[model samples]
Target: MTELIAATGSPSWDMSRTREMVRARWGDKALEALRPVLRAVTTRLIHARIHFQDYQRLVSEHLRQPLEAGTPWWELMWVDEEKGIGASNYFFIAAEGYVYAGVQAQHAIADNLAHVLYYSLGWNVDQRIPLGKVSLGTVCAQLARETTNSPELAPIQQALDALSTAPAYQALADVTNHIKHHGGLPVRVGWGTSEQTPFEVLLSAFSRKQQTQPPREIAAFLEETYDAMSRAVVTTGLALNEWLESSVAPAPPDNSLHQDSTPGGQELHPTDQPARV
Candidate 1:
């Protein structure tokens, strides 16, 4: 019977493959736990893509100007001598209440939706973290502690705490970390692989430090930082997008209607027009 079972040709599965299978089989529950975080992540990703496109456009424009003028290409135009030519980068810091509120609200709504899905699917809370409650209180306590010392951080910290307690936040955090570590463009930018921006440098530094931290602090600090980073990146991205859209050059006027002037002050007009001596 053992030999027969072994002969059935079932391929061995690795942990990642197993997890994927489980996720698929219990997608509804997983999604419920993930929707809020995923939605937040999706919005940020969209913002990032827009920012990257804008940055590319800016570089293209800078490169095109000298070429269009029939002038020798200037390396200085393509490279900011001091800062380097690239899109400005930003991140959401919990110090900014308005941006934090928006992110928290989106996360909260996603959490509620996930809870509804979980309840509808009849999944047992014991099988997973009761993200709807357990984690919420923990985050609230942490926020209270942190805010007691810094009143300015109160509102944003409170909002972040609310989102942190949600299972969806965890799911989104996992996804974002994975993407950053892997090959996603946002992560590539975040890691300082694109153009060097202050935010990119900070994120890259954080990523390197995160690998060495203990698990508990890693979780806590990451949760604290995620919203802040998101806001900064999105703001920077939007600004760059606006700049690119507004910077487009107007089409040239009809050159045929004008006359060219020589160095000796002689004018040469088109054959159809009377020449000025």
Candidate 2:
């Protein structure tokens, strides 16, 4: 039952249950809370509204064929299981700078599809990325490499290149590690509330473009920002560990004695005592 969805432009059903689990984990309140975070991340990643629009256009073109053909893009990511407790499906739409997970069984497939469609078209866009086969990291790297020719991105590329020998890239190698290893660089102050959300971290890493000095200034900025983010991740990890320990520990049993007893031999506490004379 696997198929590629038109809007998402990727094979689905592989992670349907996983998607549901993520949605469940990020309940309605959490999801609503995440919007501001996502917006912040988007703002940091994109320098201008025009660039965002261009990115959206690129992704839109990729999805147009499937939509026009009336292909079932929604079904590609749907979970066929009758019961599941975790996220089993997930997909990314580069046109929109956010990922969607089916938290509830009743999430309107058509509506979700339409939302992604409109997002690709940039009808009401904020931020986006250019369509491509490579992962977002590779895309970002490519952008950095290409920008070596541009005045704006030249410093950014230089700074990033200097750090190629540093351990930062090792942590940033994968999505989870990047998020977990680098948490709160000023560039990525607010992206998502997830324990290891990396949107902001990546944005901060890319912000080396804003440095005023040449190679030295850019290098310093990259190192400082990476250090700051790595520290934040360490702090967050410690806090999370403490919270998990408290949550998983069992509560102590109640041991208070009753002060009053009923005529029927039922034990009653003093708070349930009759009025005093």
Residues 125-148 of candidate 2 have per-residue lDDT tens digits of 232333322232433365465566
Q: Which stretches of candidate 1 lie over 4 Å from their true place?
A: 1-35, 75-124, 127-277
lDDT of 1 at 187: 17
Q: Candidate 2: which stretches are off by over 4 Å?
A: 1-136, 159-165, 172-277
Model 1 per-residue lDDT tens digits across residues 1-277: 0110111332311212212222344444553453343233334333333433443344344433434555434342344636544322221221122222323433343334233223222233343435545333443454467568756445434444545544546544544443346532131222122232211211222332345311222222333434434342223223222332333234322324322221211111111110110
How far off is residue 40 in model 1, in Å? 2.3
- Summing lDDT over every window of 10 consecutive residues in candidate 2, give the lowest-scoring window: 268-277
- Positional deviation of 143 in candidate 1, in angstroms? 32
**RMSD for each of the candidates:** 26.4, 26.3
Estimate every model's Cα lDDT from 0 to 1.
0.33, 0.28
